[model samples]
Target: MNKNKNQYINREISWLSFNERVLQETADVNVPLIERMRFLGIFSNNLDEFFKVRYATVKRIVDAGKTGKSVLGGEKAKDILEEITTIVIKQQSKSLEILGAIEKELETENIFIIDENEVTDTQAVFLKSYFMQKVSPGLLTIILNDLREFPLLKDTAAYLAVKMVLINEVDGNENKENKYALIEIPKDIDRFVVLPNEGDKNYIILLDDLIRYSLRHIFTMFTFESISAHMIKITRDAELDMDNDLSKSFIEKISSSVEHRKISDPVRFVYDKNIADDTLSFLMDKMGIEETDSKIPGGKYHNRRDYMKFPSLGRKDLMYSKIDPLPVKDFSFEGSILEQIAQKDYLQYTPYHSFSYITKFLREAALDPQVRTIKLTVYRLASNSQVASSLINAAKNGKQVTVQIELQARFDEQANIEYAEQMQAEGVKLIFGVPGLKVHSKICVIEREENDKIKRYGFISTGNFNESTAKIYTDYTLFTAYSPLLKELNKVFDFFETTYKINKYKHLVVSPHYTKNVFIGLIDQEIKNAREGKDAFIKIKMNSFTSYKMVDKLYEASNAGVKIQLIVRGICCLVPGVKGMSENIEAISVVDKFLEHTRVFIFGNNGNSKVYISSADWMTRNLDFRVEVGCPIYDEDIKQELVDTFEISWNDNVKARMFSEQQDNAYRKNDKPKLRSQFAVYEYYQKKLNA
Candidate 1:
């Protein structure tokens, strides 16, 4: 038996494969042209994060001089690092090719992305004025010759490495004294500069090209021959290091770590392949880049992620048509949303159904005289969060508002810290996090003095409370009046403040304690039912699944004749469709306009199906390290609705890619009517409204 044949796939490689599926959207003809360009942005942004985190982790293992086979599935740490670089290089090349094709297509649509040399005389005047007024003042320009120490390049910012050949004869030979300079791109300015429309045609110049056009203005002091600027970007390891200083506050350690990130070791250096060899070498030598660090020779544009903010040019036809989120059926803003929840459970499927219900609930809680206290757990919030404002409002209204804010939400630590201090100042009590656990659960519960007895109403979500992501991320928020569940949700908030008290939950499958065992028990029930001559099946939808324990248990269930179906969006390590390993299991991934973020697990318990909505994936961190919550759907209607949504996604022939041993990301095809699941989900909600 070959160990690698039917075993788990490498999580890093699987993630890259998932990102390739995202890159596929860039080349997919069916996607909107502008949207396809933005897909390239998404792909680039995804790769940047991959290098900062995953690649950095593998590199650390190799640096620590360990094979890391036990931690890294089976591959040695060095081998995985090399494999990642190879895959990234190939993907980056493919992305560039796809970008070239899109540019040509844009030209046919009368949208021209011109270079510096291609700017018209009128456009030149516009560019000069714009650069002087907007781009020049804040720009940091460093001349390399006289400087004893190299200025620290910002981790988030890209730089233009300028090579000016001093043609005039000095003590040196001709072109011998090439003066090197670095110009950091202004972060405030927009990357895409829209040139004035020429008749019916739309023209745009990238910020780098604009800088290239005005390079002389930036470096007027130097005696020059021909000068050229090539873009270069470096990604530093963004992992936060918290030293054991018992005196320092948690926020202090986090803040210091964030500041330390600016000077962290470079994990990847992306430079223009067209750049002169000397320029690249100068950067490499000065930056102290090692052989192990990924040095990728990329296209002229290093940060194509700026394309995510590509101007729409008012060409709605070249973009996705925006859909207004519909109001939930049987729910209205006229009366208390709590009153409606008192009647029956309502599920808020955001970006399909308006996320307003969440805000409305919080706003109502803030103003309601009967509402005495509010408790919530926040992992991430919007840039300008109405949710935070509502919590503060409740606090001001003399309500005891308590927030268990997780300070360790990656990439959003600064934002979380800012919100935490603001809320604390406004009289809202804030809990940083548990002793060792990141509170990943999306929950909020409020107690109201109803009829002289305390009645609790709250929501449990599979996504963050952030309204910004609610516009595009597909997630589930269950608005329930069930006291048992709310009581357990409150217990979770209690557990955040008091870590030693391990409360048993009857309704929620919580992490670090019960999630693994509870889920495994559920699978065991399915396995037994399958063996006892009963119809048995399991359907799970999540963003990732890398837990070997979960995978092995699923395989055991599959061997016992239990049919298992998985709809994992991003990283899936389980090898489905193997003859003996997982012949009864099948998996598919959907990467479309809206990210598939809802985690719904459905199990066929004899004839009745048991359903759960979770903030946790099957990954080890989610199940063991994070304070994740998986809420069982006790309301039959919501349970059925979740299962229906899962089935809709599962049966998708369009935009659905089958997960097989080959990992080719092949789209699923069928003779049945073509259904794009995201669109169908919208239609599904729409029908509910009309009904």
Candidate 2:
């Protein structure tokens, strides 16, 4: 590795380190027992996707016989694959240990997760009946011993690989045969099978165990001497390969790509290492997998992602209490949202604040008699999205409604395609996307008849408008009536419709056109201020930072004696605290109860600061390749709130880890009292509601 290589951490490795911080949360004793278990689920879920997308990409590069060192940030694709396997093994072992600790704690709380071996008579009866009623119908089983072809395994679904030691009786009239089979756990059913409580003791069994209990019934005809079962999982490449055929519609292209992804070549295979050697060999041979494939040896259970749906079982103390989403204090729907927007800008912080205000704004425009046109861009939406419904309703009423739906939003293609078709059917003008750019900007604009002239009002956000996700994913939506900015926003929509022309943005920072220049100009401002002996500093919080141009710009600012603080949640490439290099820059990553997702960029422009919440990060994909927006926080109160939130996150002692080249994930050490930022953020919003 060279100096520049040492200056930056590998993006994929940095991402795994970020997930390791999540795993740390599960092992953290301070967290509530059940919540820690949920953290394990989160860690597992994060790992699954990392393999599906990131790891799978590396494997492809390796398969194509490319070293891929430059793209992988100084690590060869093959080397990164081996590193991922090793790190994942360590993390998996840690997770098992954490699960054991959590189970011990649960027992202390009179809640037990019993397995097949530990199931009581009553629990067994309950599981048997449940299996017959619910699980049996959905169970897809195959006799592996006799089949000419091994069954294709679905990615993300866990399966039980059974090895049946059938006793072949030499009966003169009976034909005997050995048997082995596989039973896939149904994704439609709940993973946690809760049983009838016995006096204060609440018992839970995994769906896996319940299946184990019903194995005899599944293979009754075969007289098995003994049976052993273990779990196995696989993750495949998720990159969609779109056909360049002009005859195919965008929706058809997306449909075909989504279908193709299901059968994409496997990137990672995880199985119980304790599995019988014969059984393991049989599986490897049937699946046509070679020893060169990433065959990871794991423990008995896989697909811990199912724990995301772990039942509450009315155990109120075991889970975090639901924090009711607060209303945007001054913004209301009784009157025209446009009128309120015409006066000043507003910020809507989600989960801690209601997302309904966004829907309500669109709904009002859709129903209002005075509204003329509505235009917006959608990256992702809830399953039964009211946002899409309102747009459809607007179209039905003969109002102009335009939606630029991003069909390339990773893993959400089918949903976006479905919404696109539904909106098109309702007469809404649908923009597939900019020819080469994914429209990731969360923006909405409404034009209405007021004062005998057309007026504009709307908002921009740093995340998707999906209502279900809004409750968990922290994001910021800015509602504004600034005409200059609104006019530029309108121009952005026009640019989407006419991709051949690019419009100049004066106020709003738009990507693939102006974002990089604007950001670099802002950094130069800080560098100039530092040279002038003025107060110069920059504070930024984003999900990921991987753009080499931006990183070099930050380095220039740092070398010019400007202070930089970063609170990144994932994939940070910039190294801090290096002598004469990034000594002025301090970077920390905060991983806690709530996902630190909202992207906030605060530039110390000689103390006359400019703050922006953007849907785009500093990554190359977000800057030059996607249609993303970064809206300035014009509301004084909202700007101060953003500053305070950033400060609080920077002050996090608990759940905050230093981003360093060592990848140690060391918790930020401080003499100050413990402050978990997410909990504090919730209280901060709560106090605002009380005030």
Candidate 3:
């Protein structure tokens, strides 16, 4: 097929549009004051990762002198790079404006985010003591002018570029020599330092400003006429470059790659717009940064991602009210959870439902005498993960526990490597995953002996088995003792051990072999139903959708009169609502307090519906490169509940942005009452519990 350029959005451009939605949260009036500031932080953090990974990839293509049109969704790689920089610069400027408005509103609430210039004498005394006692111990300062080679700047670490006009003359001439230095911001310290509260006001100082205030103290030995400091940061390419060293273990290779990322090629350089021209040029020249590289001019602060951890100041009124996680309806914590699942299927929707259910299940498996074996896949886990502890506990209890932990989970390599070593040390048999594919599936199956027969019980999820993220990331976990599905899930684990042999799954949708074909078959069925004048529709919720083949298939379905609704949270390359191409398709993205991380696919199979919760999106990597899983919803009640939740998100009038060809992330508005899906989902589950 000859692909048209206008048929789809470039993936990089779509990603920027998604980040813009996050930036919009900072400007929302209805959003809580402190939460808005944190949204700005989230936006900044998302941009850093974009540059480190996506932007870096395009830069590589440009460096290779390749057009890269076929891979980049019909756009040249060089053009995409330029477009990304332009879009990012504008978004950075807009974010600053939003930050300004949020600060003004915060002042009205008796909170002040004062900088170094605004520090009072009383605050100065407090700051100086805090700096000496807390900051000075960990601060890294480098004198740059005298060294022949400039020190390597850490990626994403903000630094203060200090330039001082020295008092002494240079080379016996009248010219004064300039001394330059770089001070690494101490990350161990809190970015927002809350000062002692006065009568009715709260004061907080950013760590950047506190360091700026202490520049004189930091350079007390040097005598200079004047001094100034500006914030600068560099983002490096984060792609892991694994070596072919037969002598090294897989863990060693991943650790080496992670360590190498510290000095990888720089993809972006951002500096304060108000910085001295001489200072900016000198630093760039010293670092060998070229004009062609992405150099973004920004406000005073460089790493605004720190704002994600902005102090709450005990102001419950300035943030969204925390919702207590509800118990899954009809699934009690009392007695054996395994016994309960053996009777019927249950779905645990996290944040709305307690994550403790996962931990509870694992802990039960670890202690149960009948449980003989447990196997699962590990992608990303929380720091001090209870999941890891439970796995270790299971292994220590003499149960044969096998873990296929992916050590290359992007910026999580080091953490996973550490967890892998810990689990291996505690007698958990470790599988490093298939050589060519990262195991991204979230599945667990335990074999328990009952009446001379081995009964299998398992759970499949749309998110990682991490407790910390479960509080804010909305996902679905299906607990079932159905032997048919559990048997196929065991086949997935078996594939991890023997990569060359292909496995067939009759129940669970396994990726890298069957997912694309299965989903295509499902879409084809819907297309046939629409042609037959039968009930035909499709609903999907995912983090991203960039597979062009799938987009074309959806377009074909839409052309055939199949009604399609998509809730994609990020990087949707498919252009929805286009006339002739996708007129019957509509898509929306919801960004609110909780991240919409679940991936659910519902297809109207003539009057009956087929529902699935998947670990994968329709992205190319997920479809053909990574090992992913999508399990069908067989239980009638659970399937209806999944449909109900997707409907709530689909009908969200607030916090939902429509995806269109214009790429302007416009919020969906209507005469109908405002319904925030995140809050409404909680209420839906609450009523279920009450019933």
Candidate 4:
């Protein structure tokens, strides 16, 4: 199957297809009812990103004609744009069908999503009270007829496009023209307006319903014969451009870019186009949204991501019960984490195990009198980050804290900038990233003065050190005080200070130079073993596997009879399980309660196995452009744990989707016992803790 004439599927188009798989989750009847609703939230969130980034890029391409092809990865910008619109239209239709199915299922459970018209007398009174007390204060209604200048609509916020027919004559049949107005749904208020329950039946009203109920009050001055409203939302370009002005601080440049993002041109204009032409035209004309923008026909409600926080209504049956994170077996809270690392390396499996170990280690470092210096890289951090707090504490206690915080972590520019400022004010030395490269590596090194020598203790991770995200994002954190590894890591920090001076690494695989070659060499080793008739295999679990070079290499290894298994959670361009080409290759994607965010690679070299946990996926950008780190799991126990996790995921028959070129998103089938990897992973860690 030569898909090469297609060269490569447009990244944006492929991303939309990936989202279609998510939408499939909502449509799948096998999925639990409440979980299906949450899938809707995931779908909405995905579309918001599609518009902000992918669609925005396409829009830029369409505007810039010929030059757009290079940016779009071999596809013409216009061709990609047309393809995305067609695909999105189909996906939207599918979404509606999914919603209809979900609504029907909700009815079976006695959970009715009541609209404004369906509300009874008692419910209306409660809803009215809710409107007054909760939503009214935050509502911004723009009188379209009166305003001199059009209001600048905030991207991602839903607005009600209102049409009112003024009662001009006594006769009800008199020809009266309609007036248009706009009301932005207050994002601060809960989108779900829970109504009083009637015995066993649960009732809920959407925030849109409340707004629909209170529409007359919003426009009391203008008399109308008839009124109608529909939800509309616009998504704008989110790409930030860095200024080359050396005088301005990095934080200032990011802040300015964020401000610029607010007024960025609309990429997609999604509306309940059941709206009258006059109303649509009035809003479109005022918003300056032209035909070039992708105008999508959508349902009455937009921004369904609000449903992610959908109130459980104390219904325990409707929600997944919280799983308590188990403690890591080898690493304990009693003694110094550094001391344990000093003896041998340890692995931390987050979400399955408490992420507090990372925090505790840093806190220990901050308090340890012998510790003189600490260095780390920050990409995306939590709002109230314990990592930042710990680093600041270290700086306060006379420890030299060096942080290379990336100011351009997408959607997190403002947060990282704020963090950089806070860390700088606390006397923590800040490196505003290498001139052009984004520091995507997650590494921390603490230098402790012990026995007349400085010994380094730190952890390298495949995920960020954000505690809040650690609860839901499955990631690996490798803790080690191995002198060789630490020395190489210290060199990585030094490279950030001195970008022109590139250093060779012996242990750790540093990206932008060594990562690609190192990975290729390892894969070649497996291939060589397969050629020699030795037991050879490769297992990788990553967020995405889109690099063509890596794909081709894997394909070659597969043809050579090397067993290849991949558990990619998102974006897999390489189709697995073809007859001759990839008969030895198998790929599955697991999407469950926790996001499978960890990147693990296992290579079988003869009888010995080498496992690695990396911050980078097998993506070209990660390998060639970004500063990523892939560290070997030298600790035997940790390597075994990673192997076990990969196996558990590989064995997953439930919640694992088979990835094919067909894009069916079919569930992996097996006669074996049901295995959901996320659940199995948790159980495995729990058992480890108990043992």
Which candidate gets the maximum lDDT versus the true structure?
3
Q: Name the regions of candidate 4 deviating beyond 4 angstroms.
A: 1-9, 28-31, 67-74, 146-148, 169-175
lDDT string for model 2 (28-53, tens) is 87876778888888999999889889
Candidates in descending lDDT order: 3, 1, 2, 4
Q: If scored against the real structure, what TM-score would every candidate get?
A: 0.98, 0.97, 0.99, 0.95
RMSD of model 4 against the true structure: 2.3
Predicted candidate 3 versus true structure: per-residue lDDT over 1-691, tens digit per residue:
2334589899999999999999999999999999999999999999999999999999999999999999998899999999999999999999999899999999999999999999999999999999999999889999998789999999968999999998876787656778899999988889999999999999999999999999999999988889999999999999999999999999999999999999999999999999999999999999999998999999999799999998899999999999999999989999999999999999999999999999999999999999999998999999999999999999999999999999999889999999999999999999999988989999999999999999999999999999999999999999999999999999999999999999998888988999999999999999999999999999999999999999999999999999999999999999988788898999999999999999999999998999999999999999999999999999999999999999999999999999998999999999999899999999999899888
In model 2, what lDDT does residue 144 have?
Answer: 86
Q: Give the runs in model 1 whose Cα sits over 4 Å from its true position.
A: 1-6, 170-175
Candidate 3 or 2, higher lDDT? 3
Give the total clashing residue pairs for model 2. Answer: 0
lDDT of 2: 0.87
lDDT of 1 by residue, 66-130 (tens): 99999778789999888988999999999999999999999999999999999889999999999
Candidate 2 clashing pairs, residues 3+ apart or interchain: none
Q: On a 0 to 100 scale, what is the lDDT of residue 358 in model 2?
A: 91
Query: In terms of TM-score, how similar is model 3 to the real structure?
Result: 0.99
Question: Which scores better on TM-score, 3 or 4?
Answer: 3
Error of 1 at 218 (Å): 2.0
Per-residue lDDT tens digits of candidate 4, residues 570-605? Answer: 878676777666778888888777888999999998
